[model samples]
Target: MTTTVPRTANSADTRGWSRWAAALILPIGPAAVAVLRYVLPYDTVDDSATMVSKVVAAPGRMSLVLWLGFIAVLTLVPAAYSVGRVTRQRAPRLTMVALLLLIPGYLSLGWLTAEDQFLWSGAKAGMDAGAITRLADAMHPSAAVAGVFFVLGHVLGTILLGIALWRTRVVARWAALAVIVSQPIHFIAAVIIANHPLDLFGWGLQAVGFAAVGWAILKLPNDKWA
Candidate 1:
């Protein structure tokens, strides 16, 4: 016998909002981050002063990325919640672990972006290159370690999330596969292509993954899953 669970009025309302939030945030967040990367100066992992100079050269444009990118990352909270709900039945444990990894991954990225503004201000103030170099060198160790963890969290979280969604059959399997593949592709592309506008292709793959998840969420009927 098949027993169907009934959704309450409040539950229905929450699901509706969650679906909409997922639909909007999933695509928008990655799109914003990709656009920012395309518009900003090419990124170099080791060149702090050069980065600061680029941003300080056009503080206004940098501010657009700084603020908008932060907002886009914040949207990950809702996106995570939606994912948890989607994978609750078949892969609850995996989803939980993925969320744990994702929180710190996004946080490290966000903190670094905010920290860059401080560097920008120093550059704008005509600080001596020697002083800036000393500061950058001093910060390098901790930053490098955090950067490693950031990459680990993102790659691991992506794999776990994709596997969970795929195993549960809650979303399209191809979409889950895309989400899994996008991470490593983005990293390799960033390395090989370095700082070209073509990097958008790598980032766009991430957006496609998110868009697929969002579409999957939207396709769920009101009474489908809690």
Candidate 2:
């Protein structure tokens, strides 16, 4: 015989708020990032000198973009965890692997944001663009490792999570396909084609997928949230 454990009032309340928070944040973070990316004149092919020059040229706008990215990064884990939770019942192993990769991947944003901050600070101090580039190139080994982790983990994790979502039928199949394809599009746009508009479109697809997932989460009853 199996025994059922009762949930406490506090536990239920926590689940309710957590679910709502995750649902709200899931789409908002990616959508905000997508719009901010479009607002910023970002070119993937830009060298460090060019990058520093752009930042210095529009410090106020660059600062705003950086802070918005930082805020979006803060929301990543909760949003990702909620997605993982939805897949856990049908695709437990895939969910676990995705979460393992995503958690550290999202956490590594600290290193990335620090690098951006360093660039902004150097530019603010009237440092030469080349000098700022040199300093950025000399970032510590740990930071480099974090950068690698951030790139690989988020890209691969999202792909796996999308596959899990597809298999589980948790969200719309097209939405799951959007999530799976989004990162590849991002990589191609950012690295191969070096097209800012394409990059924005890729992120827009991510926002679309996340919005679908968030809607599904919101539809769940509070008792089932946990």
Candidate 3:
């Protein structure tokens, strides 16, 4: 007779790992991306050609950040879900609507990150300079097309979620506001500053926002939140 481990135990282990991942990544992911953007050779919105050129010429740093972003967004999902779960009992409708709005934002961000991989692939493929440049140019329009959804998903979603969390007192009010304000601040700065590095200042603020979310979630008992 063969003795078998219980499925429930294995399932429990998987869930535990997932929770730990969410706890760790929810904070670290956004924080890292915040700093990473400053170090990476990112062109301003006006210089789409330069941005494309840089990616094709040296995709290493940008690729790394994008890959990290991809993973970070995944981790954010469960963490956000936990936030909704914990707050739902207190503010059911708000939590539900917040998640619905925020999830699409995360997905749009994920798509942009995943597209960065294609840049790396093209660079590695030994394409001629003209071919690579052409490809990069071709890819440029996609960002403009997808940006509408990105704004709707992340900016609107975050604002709504932040408001929900604030109203419910699920997280610190200031922290909730930080998350809510991050995207809009970043965009406004980017627009005002235009080509300057300061355009990315919002990333730093976003780090604070995400960190607060992580702290709020982790500080609570797992059974209460998870």
Clashes of each: 0, 0, 1
Order of models, best TM-score first: 2, 1, 3
The sequence of per-residue lDDT tens digits that candidate 2 reaches over residues 3-34 is 99998777537776777788888976666666
Q: What is the lDDT of residue 6 in candidate 3?
A: 64
Span of ten consecutive residues with least summed lDDT in model 2: 35-44
| Model 3 per-residue lDDT tens digits across residues 34-83 | 65555455544645456556776676777676766766676656656766
1 or 3, greater by lDDT: 1
Model 1 lDDT per residue over 14-133, tens place: 767767777888767666766776777537454766766676577777767777678767875566567767886788789999988876776677756756666656666888766765
Please report the candidate that would top lDDT against the real structure: 2
What TM-scores do the predictions have? 0.80, 0.89, 0.75
> What shift in Å separates residue 53 of candidate 3 from its native position after superposition?
2.2
User: At residue 21, what lDDT does model 1 achieve?
Assistant: 72
Residue 201 displacement (Å), model 1: 2.0
In order, candidate lDDTs are 0.71, 0.82, 0.64
Index of the highest-TM-score prediction: 2
lDDT of residue 87 for candidate 3: 67
lDDT of 2: 0.82
